[model samples]
Target: MSTAEAGRGPRLVPVRAADGRVGWSLVAANGRRLAAAVRSYRSDRELASGICELLAERAVLRFVLSQREDRLWIWTAHLPARSTRAGAGGGEAVARSARGYLRRDQCRQSVAAFRQGADHVQRLRRLAGGAFPSSAW
Candidate 1:
């Protein structure tokens, strides 16, 4: 039986990225990644809070697992919060589609990454003189 189906399902795991960056991801039971941080986080606390916020805001997330090129893989997406309140007085819904993961697992991770990516883009806009180039390290 798939580990996920064996009562474990998907879970958020603390990840120390290959470049030594740190973040969180919701992984399948087989230890395959479902979704992950777009970049990385400076601290674990930030990562935890980030994941929590993602769950609270986003309403849709997608995870796919399959075999490709002789390897098992995952693809994931975290769609933006739905605009249930849209109406004549409301402006047109802004487009927000953030997909992550060289490996994808589940919806929660995708949402977290989406919001995290938005935060990174905002950081880019506020870059000052010689402010470390980019959010990517």
Candidate 2:
């Protein structure tokens, strides 16, 4: 999964799977809308993490969707600063910067977990053929 800037929004494009299926997600900054599409998932968790990774890179905000032990979290990074507020006190701004970026870390961890889960489910489905239920993920 990778993110590419598209117009005013961000476009997320994923590589086609072995079954010739592609998934995509798009989000506009300023909290406009969220769009997602999924095709074939030979395994339940095939592209779980991928979706999150794409969103994290392009989103200014994200929504998480998961079930039971299988969790999927989504996040968007802040858009580039368009302006700097004057008289905001540079000292305070500097202090805030020292806090580091918690949001970025959260997004990264969520994507990693989702990726791991997807890989596990994919292997299970492949081994079990069509015996595994789609809801198992």
Candidate 3:
């Protein structure tokens, strides 16, 4: 594991594949360590929606079972603009629309959609009975 400092208290370590893709782990001052990998796909709204469904499963498992507030935050990090089209406020607009329909107070649905867009890597981790540590979301 390679380590670098993140801000004041935590350290970040990257978990890399032979192909050079990286997943990360965050080590906090209190000894809490979280790790997760990130992956991006071609911009397709349908694929994005499917990812959200998978993430909802993970959120239920991670947050509800572990009682972790950080799960929601980690879930959001999975979304990043993968294409210029999606980047031109499209992804954000989609997310905003989802949130609007779900109602802001319904944290579960909001998080579920975020998973759809960004949390496939985490879903894999969950399937393997593991967790991804992320600072995004």
Q: Which predicted model would earn the best lDDT?
A: 1
Greater lDDT among 2 and 3 belongs to 3
Clash count, candidate 1: 3
Clashing pairs in 3: 34-133, 35-132, 35-133, 36-132, 36-133, 51-116, 52-115, 52-116, 76-137, 77-137
User: lDDT tens string, model 3, 8-127?
Assistant: 334334445566444444334454443333442333343344344434544343322112343322223323334776435423211211112223345555445434434444433344
lDDT, model 1, position 79: 39
Error of 3 at 20 (Å): 5.9
Number of clashes in every candidate structure? 3, 2, 10
**For model 1, how does the per-residue alpha-carbon lDDT over 1-137 read when each residue is reduced to its tens digit?**
33223234344456697776676554544555545555466776676555545554434444333445745343434435446665533321222222323454543455455445434433432352323122221
- Which 10 successive residues of model 1 have the least lDDT summed? 128-137
RMSD of each: 13.8, 17.6, 14.7
TM-score-wise, the better of 1 and 3 is 1
Query: Against the correct fold, how does model 1 do in TM-score?
Result: 0.39
lDDT of 2 by residue, 1-137 (tens): 21221122332323356776655433323332233343433443556554433333332223333232334334322223335787543221000010112355554664444343334433444444533323222
Output the lDDT of residue 54, model 2: 31
